[model samples]
Target: MSETTHAGNGISTEQAGVEQELVDTVLASFDKAEDPRLMEVMQALTRHLHNFLREVRLTEAEWNTGIDFLTAAGHITDDKRQEFVLLSDVLGASMQTIAMNNQAYKGATEATVFGPFFLEDAPEIPLGGDIAGAAAGQPCWVEGTVTDTSGNPVPGARIEVWEADEDGFYDVQYSDSRIAGRAHLFTAEDGSYAFWGLTPTPYPIPHDGPVGKMLKAVGRSPIRASHLHFMVTAEGLRPLVTHIFVEGDPQIEIGDSVFGVKNSLIKKFETQPVGTPTPDGRDVHSQSWARTRFDIVLAPGSDLR
Candidate 1:
């Protein structure tokens, strides 16, 4: 190879002429990065990426197409929606990540993906109030207690809850003046919380991205199981992000589109007489809902694991 002198950065121009050379040079500069965590992540990323490229003999056109797909995914995002999250849901990455860190909360309500639809600062409803906005689906009365893994009650804990209506749509999916079907409630003195809501339904993820295309290519459905999303937390305790699956929902056993449902999370809800009052004294006569119980046992320490 012919050596050519270059003025900038001291290397011979021939060694620095190619795009790959520039990438390597930029990566090499990270060796002196002060943050250990950042350096570890960057080094692993570089190693895996280089290995992938070499293993697949990746072509420039293929790499460019991947970039374009990701760009298109980002372009489809909006304030109330996240296309990248939908992509993760379809690719099972969301559940995998949740499972990885949630293992320590083993005996607790098993954690699941906090799908993109959760609203921040949800309306603060009272302990037994309904979060469901509209008259949709059969009524369901969900009752649960928040406790530590040691079986001790956790009073004053907060549980943020959200779920889809009967039609498998979130409130954000529509633009009416109706309140969002979500709520934040503080646990009662007995570590208990109860609420009225409609039964959950399987829902489709956004199907207009490369992730959707991948799902189609694999002959898989994009519908997630009917379940409730909960983020429960108490002072001095690790927060819990989890779901309660409706028993008999075939999607739970077969396969959730996001691979989120766990067998231990399934709870059976039984229909009760319309005139019957719930444990919290709410009359069911108006909607004829069923009752289901869920008790969450939080893992201790600062880490939920």
Candidate 2:
């Protein structure tokens, strides 16, 4: 191989070796990171990132465009909206992280994306309580039980649930500062829980920002499959974050925007005609509703292995 010199930094100018020396220099710089995990992560990230750049032979203009897009995303992000999380979801990064951290154990429910819409300190509801606090959607009867892999009840497990309204907006997305479509509730001594929530519905991700523009450029749709979010926490079990996707939803065929749909997570949201007897006898005059059962199983301990 003929060695051509590219003056300044003494970087190799050989065809295949052009980027190798720079990669080595960057990896070596992380040797003193003090934290072994950080060092490993940085070195691995550097290698894969460099490999991507080299594989694409990315032009300076394309690189600058990416920077500009991220800058725009940052500017639009605030306490209420997270543009970066949306970006990660569209790129499959969020699901990949969840898969790596949520190890499979006996009968334990799988974990999915912890979307940006989650709010802290959601209101607590009683058994068969309604969480729709004013958001409009068909009433959904959600009942479930929390148990260990051995079928032992996890009494008093706290389940946090949240979902978008029928119009595809979370409570936080509204400028009025209203709170609805989200709440937490604990299980009974028998590990059973129930509440009234909206039936899952398909919705587009926040698409008025930089991530939206990128999706357009890539010919991708921003639609997420219909799903209801759940986060279950018990005293001695691993925290489970997941969603129950609606079965037979046409959107699933197209794929979830966040790549979060799992076959095990899909459940039947059965439609009940008007005048059906309510489980808790909550009145919904002349309104049809839906019902679903999602029994949860949590693995013991918090080890991510």
Candidate 3:
């Protein structure tokens, strides 16, 4: 690289010659975008990307490697598996976006990442019914109430729940079945709900693709703390996407791979002796059961369109 100096500017003209021209041309191409927001975003993105390349003095080999990695990520993605989300999560971009979008409300449940495993049209179950569906794990009784910021019950709220089994595998992970540990139900008149589920256990995030290779290269673990996923919504409130983490899970202190754990969302799972009667009138006979209560508070707002 030869340096060409500008007498008045006191800077190397070569550094700005080709780089600035490319950036200006790219940014100018977006000037005719019909949507104002699209134009603004493209302009900002182009400038930032060009600035990054200049700062790093990126080599052609390195840039090609990045393109190849992203191509691999896209090729691995499908209807059930999302490699791009895993890539965003490991890079911290997903968590940063979640934090920016979810400002804290007075009494609303804190929001977290909606992991890639959530299935559309999960089976609907009656309140107090079991969602385990032949999955193997310690039986647990989960009960809760839904209330607004003003402390009034929000009846008929839809609650969607899902989790992994004791062996740390979601229903989608199994080749033979895809219906365990997931259900949706509505709150009763008093905003109370209950269901049978498994005690959450620490599990590794899916890690056999590009994201996993990246983690290995960076010496980061792929574990996520034990937690039950929840998505709650009502007639006129901001929807809550969160999880109730198991209090004593060792992975919690290490931090979740997806960055979804919140201190306010942690809850204790108490062990009940065998032969104990449950709130829903089921008796624990051969195996002891675990129990926990998690009440939800929704932020008062217009429904999401």
Candidate 4:
């Protein structure tokens, strides 16, 4: 008979001995994977998963609850709602992956989680146009330039922006077919772009799902800091998907639900009085308006596949 050993959880030697054998068995099953990357990933995933279970001494009830939670998360996901991504964000996994993929490039904008609400083929708005649609919110003017890491302009770059209304709800939140606070536009000759948006306001992430329940169970809030989402792309440079956080937002200091905020992305939103001239040559009619500038620097190099 093999020598006996006891785990921290008092798991018997026979049980702990079978654990490594189990991991080895699972890894061996992936030996026939056609892709080498697939085999490597499977082996690593098996090792990590086994290690996690062994370290935590997970119980059957807890494992069942996790499975149920994931099942519910998938059940609620659809065209407009992505509960899985929300789950990943709250787990800090998404941010960790982003940090790993986006190595530091001098002058290049730091990347963050691409929250679940970004829509493809968002309405295209011309320069100096308004993207707020009919959404109710304080008007905000957003202007910026797209440049390479070396400070050279990236002409004709595509800049996409989206945000929630002052009510902290995105256009997709509504059942009706209304588009608000989302648009895309191209940078002008000198790599400049301008558009009207809404003053960012802190809002809770969609908490009507499994992720919400998990947060509640863990005594965590589901609130995300106020910010506007941006995805900038240009020829011969890596795409930048990021957000500009509103400076002084109480939520900023407290911590974002998804851990997405960065010091460099914080910008002051200046409040302008009525009758102030807008950058696009339009007059501000509201009692007060806000403006912000967010210049983006893209890293040189294309995505390798």
Candidate 5:
């Protein structure tokens, strides 16, 4: 019998060496990948994955369970919904990748998760126009200035914004073709932009899928902190995707399901009582409103980009 086949009461060194041999064999198959980066990634993935499985001494049943979970996620992902991104978000993989790529530079605004709801065809809003076409929520006035790291104004910067309505549902969640709570607008020559939208409230990520089941299995909450999404781009600046989380959200104190909350991103959404004067002098009738200002700074473009 082969030495590797010998059974023992405890884990044997020979078995460990045999497992490593299998890992090396798998990694060697990636050597012909024309891309050196792909080869490196494959090799590293093999090593880490094998190490984790060995560390946990995963059983055949557990491995099958994992495969089934991934299959379920794949089955649920589609054009409007992304189950894999949700899985990555819940596992902190998305945030880790964001952190590794978006290292601190100057005073550039911090980036966060680009949640699954962003749409490429969001309607355009003129400066100081309204984005809430038909979404239902308390009204909010969002204004911000886009500037470079040096604090110079960045004119013509495109700002994309989206958020869920009062009931914590994004426009894409509707059955009928409804678009609301999302729009894009260009910064003015002075780098200022404003829009009327819904006041953000804490919302649960789509929890009816495989990712949600996994979260429930681990006794974790699927609730994310209340925040509005932003994606900013310009001529010579690194694109910024981030959020301004509403202050005092209970989920922020407990924890954002996606681990996306940053202290710098937290801002107070000041409440305006009924009949208070509105910015831009727009009429809100007898309903109170909310207002917030987010100043965005962009990092310079890099040669590699």
Candidate 6:
């Protein structure tokens, strides 16, 4: 029957198909949807899901199993944790879509997945503050400058940083008392910023649900390369969401969990002697761990101001 006739009534139709049923259900809920963007999202999602079902000829048993997996995923979410984000990480959706959209602002730095561990209010600190705490790991002195494409520094840019501990776990993953590996540093008058944090270590994503099952079925590992996450923004420059992966991270040149790793973003942390002064004016640089520098370039824009 025609779509118009099927609109208001659940008219019995033996010839009804899965796509038709999906359209009717989705359209009914979106009857008041007037935004073009919202309509595009709904239409694309509907088309893709229908196409996927037809391509696989999905069975009822398989669908039920999928539903159970999703249920478990949602059940795992808590006030401080998000299982849905984990699912996206494992499925590579987070990186694929975020990276695709971030490509327009290339030359800033390669953006990566921001696994759900960032806090709403990270303590604001001055540049070169010690962020590594007392955790015993490779000492990495990271210094960088926020600049515009024309090569001028974007002074007073705020930079937020977070990375795994020497043991590959964020401070939040350990105890609330432990806030290591997370720092908020702002650029100096010349747009230069510096800090000390432990070198990030490779770690595994949460593997407990439908996404984990899919990983097993595909014979893929849940490990992600070690890296540092940074969100930098200035008064007039575009905000940059990116990461600096550890040099030689096996997953860097090879298999990244979400294909978000880029060669140019890999940084080598070089060890220093034990008698040199630390970046923060401490006289222990020689005995310190290592150091790496990264300069960020932002495109001209006042959108993030």
lDDT leader: 2
How far off is residue 81 in model 2, in Å? 0.8
| Off by more than 4 A, model 4 | 1-3, 302-305
- Tell me the TM-score of each prediction against the true structure: 0.86, 0.94, 0.93, 0.96, 0.96, 0.85
User: For residues 94-172, could you state the per-residue lDDT of candidate 3 as single tens digits?
Assistant: 7788777777878688888888889989999999998889788999999989999889999999999999999999998
Give me the runs in candidate 2 sitting further than 4 Å from their true place: 1-18, 302-304
Q: In candidate 2, which residue pairs clash?
A: none
Q: Which stretches of candidate 5 lie over 4 Å from their true place?
A: 1-9, 303-305
Candidates 4 and 6, the one with greater lDDT? 4
| lDDT (10s digit) by residue, model 2, range 1-305 | 55554443343468546578889999999999999999999999999999898767789999999899989999999999999999888899999999998878887999999898999999998988989999999999999899998999999999999999999999999999999999999999999999999998999999999998888888999999999999999888889999999999999999898999999999999999999988988788889999999999998876848
Error of 4 at 183 (Å): 0.7
Ranking by lDDT: 2, 5, 4, 3, 1, 6
147-166: candidate 1 lDDT, tens digit per residue: 99889999999999988888
Residues 1-305 of candidate 6 have per-residue lDDT tens digits of 64442333453343346457766787567657899789778877876787687557689999998898889878878766687887787677988877666665546655677787877677776777777775657777889888887788887888889877767677776656677778787888888989877777887765665666778889987777888889887877666777888786677655766565877778887777777667566655346567899998887664322
lDDT of 3: 0.89
TM-score, cand. 6:
0.85
Candidate 2 residue-wise lDDT at 99: 92
lDDT of 6 at 191: 87
Q: How close is candidate 1 to the true structure, as a TM-score?
A: 0.86
Backbone Cα, N, C clashes tallied per candidate: 2, 0, 0, 0, 0, 8
Between the candidate structures 2 and 4, which one is better when assessed by lDDT? 2
lDDT of 2 at 261: 97
> Residue 5 lDDT in model 3?
62
